[model samples]
Target: MKKILIAHDGSKSSDKALRKAFELAGKFGSSVTVISVIPELYLTELMDIDRARILETLTGETTRTMEKIKASVKDVRTVRTMIRQGNPASEILDAAKKMKADLIITGSQGRHGAEKFLLGSVSSKLVDYAECSVLVVK
Candidate 1:
């Protein structure tokens, strides 16, 4: 694969996916783009006025997490980091298409039944919408 996109959320599942991406990249010498999505919605009781501050906090956290991943990976291959504000699934799919990715890797919490339906799993949505091959790591 020329380009591989991985959705990362700084979780163990995502860490597994990153390792898988590293393995594939090593095999094919593919460049990897790591994406972290920050949802824009606040809690029902949260004030809109504080949205900017909250978003700033979230962005900083995400950036730090990506940086940690980069450091741990240790120049394994070409890596690009992205932090986006929006629905995770849609943004990931859009990025994959825009980047012309041949493969996508993402983490799954492995939800079930009502919880999966109500929450709309990002990994599930990505598999449904992505044009390229999607690997959902458990």
Candidate 2:
């Protein structure tokens, strides 16, 4: 069965990307793997390594997000969820590779000009570097 990877971050844009992934998965009779990349800030050496707290928070948030995304899927595609901690762009690409996903779906925050210059767009970087096809949802 086809596999599609979605990069979600609890943002509205990311939610839209999730919907798009659902659509594509339905079209292709594909299974979806929803991946949430917890920013490295939460895993820094400065913070107390409250493993239980961190895992709880991540699990709850990912569960909620997955529920919303799953509700939008009209097809009977199988689904899987994953949460990882790292840089969003690299982590997303790595997850896609590891899952053998045929497509990588992510949202573009629509930042432009100086803002985008200062903070490089994750979607842009993924589009450039991902081994599979990337669908950048607006």
Candidate 3:
């Protein structure tokens, strides 16, 4: 693969996926792009909150997270990090399409019960809709 995209959310499963992506990148000499998305502020919409301030705070947090990820994978050449705001699955898919990534790696959130049934996990959504190959790490 020439380009590999990783969907990371700082969970244990996502950390495993990141390692796997780095390993594959090392083997194939592929460029790696890590993307983290901030979900829409649905709850904040209901509350009397400063939407812009909340969004700004979230953006800063996401930036810090991406920076830490970049530092952790400093050995890997051609590593890129991106922060997006929207539905995680949709944003990730869009990023992959824009980057022309050959592979998309993401971690399973392991949501169960009503939540999983009502709203499918991000990994599942990406696997079902992504045009490119998707690897869902547990």
- The window of 10 residues in a row where model 1 has the poorest summed lDDT is 110-119
Candidate RMSDs in Å, in order, are 3.1, 3.7, 3.0
Q: How close to the true structure is residue 24 of candidate 3, measured as C-alpha lDDT?
A: 92
Put down candidate 1 lDDT per residue, 18-111, tens digits, no spaces: 9999988888989999999998675877787787789888899999999988887753579999999898888999999999999999877532
Order the candidates by lDDT, highest first — what do you get?
3, 1, 2
* Candidate 2 positional error at 44, Å: 6.5
Against the true structure, what is each candidate's TM-score?
0.87, 0.77, 0.85
How does each model score on lDDT?
A: 0.84, 0.77, 0.84
lDDT of 2 at 15: 77
Candidate 2 lDDT tens digits, 1-138: 388888888777777788788877888889999888766654456446576677678778877876776676678469887878778889989888888889888877632323533323777898899999988886
| Candidate whose TM-score is highest | 1
Predicted structure 2, TM vs. truth: 0.77
- State the lDDT at 50 in candidate 2: 78
